[model samples]
Target: MTRSNTARRTVAALLTAGVSAVLMTAAPAHADSNDSCHPSGAMPRVGVFGNEFAPAPSDPLVRAQGWVDAGLTCSPMGSFGGYRTDAGGYAAMAWRLTESMEPSELLSTGSVTPLAGRDDLAPGDGLLNPAGFGHAVVFDHWADDAHTSYLGYEFTAAGVQHRTIPYPYFAGQGDFRPVRAAR
Candidate 1:
């Protein structure tokens, strides 16, 4: 081959290799798993919902906040009335709004705290300090009758995703408290 043709082939080969490398790195870590339950196309997705179980906020950060980037600050969403944080790093903050509510107001909101171990959580119940990561997730459902598996919308490094985690993982971590919010 001529000198010019040889150089062109070499350039093409480099371009192909570069594209392959990018594709490999971009692939999902878990091949068999998915992130959310949105495929249902139903109102109040199985796990996390925004503003009265209507639907999750369009903004990913608002839907689920994580440790590093986006939605790092926690705030009460609505009547369920609790606190959240996407605050990055090892920073931990707890805002106890439940203590100030009158008995009547508390009844109206049906807000309960630290109830994870005490009762069978229903879908939509909020999980505080899940996985001991100081992360928050909305209870989706139990993966099994024994309650060994848990599914929820977790605010993760991959953004808000529908995740299924083993109970032992969180149990080992300790301090999994459940809070229920009235619709």
Candidate 2:
């Protein structure tokens, strides 16, 4: 064979081998089995809405403050209000606007604090704190008989658009129901 022809074949073989190596090393792109909020074969499409708090502007400010980069998953079975995080990602900040609102005691201690801005607490006061505000909040509203709603908020925090999903209603609270996956 001609020298040029031999060179061309060697180059082609090397290219093919390189391509195969890359394909083998690549991890499979599969739906997160660990994610409870995401249904099987469902890709997570994050959408941002308005803030949960108004007048005082809690939602906008929270976005502006920016939370840590974290992954969250919520499932329907077991505890209706249960939440999970991405191990380590972004930190959260909490802002308790009401005197009766305490997030740490409620989320961690499993104790229920009075809803902020209720008749008992001042109009603008709701348990607002920065402690867990920067962390990603995920709620699994898809479980049957689960009365939790998942809300995703997008706001500019430190000049960046941050996305947050909060479960404000759970277990006989606001009307939160799961959505069926699109066929």
Best by TM-score: 1
lDDT of 1 by residue, 1-183 (tens): 999999999999999999998964673442112222112222211222234432234332233333223323222221222222221111111112223222123323444445537256766555554321234455667888888877765533343345676652344334445655442
TM-score of 2: 0.20
Candidate 1 clashing pairs? 35-162, 72-86, 72-87, 74-84, 74-85, 116-178
- Report lDDT per candidate: 0.40, 0.27
For model 2, how does the per-residue alpha-carbon lDDT over 1-183 read when each residue is reduced to its tens digit?
999999999999999999998964463222111322323342221222222321233442342233223212222121111112111111122232211111222334322233432123221112222133211222212222342322332111121122222333222222322211111
Superposed model 1: Cα runs more than 4 Å off: 1-112, 116-119, 130-133, 168-174
Off by over 4 Å in 2: 1-61, 68-112, 116-148, 153-183
Residue 53's lDDT in candidate 2: 26
User: How many clashing pairs per prediction, in order?
Assistant: 6, 27
Prediction 1 TM-score vs. true:
0.40
Q: For candidate 2, give the lDDT.
A: 0.27
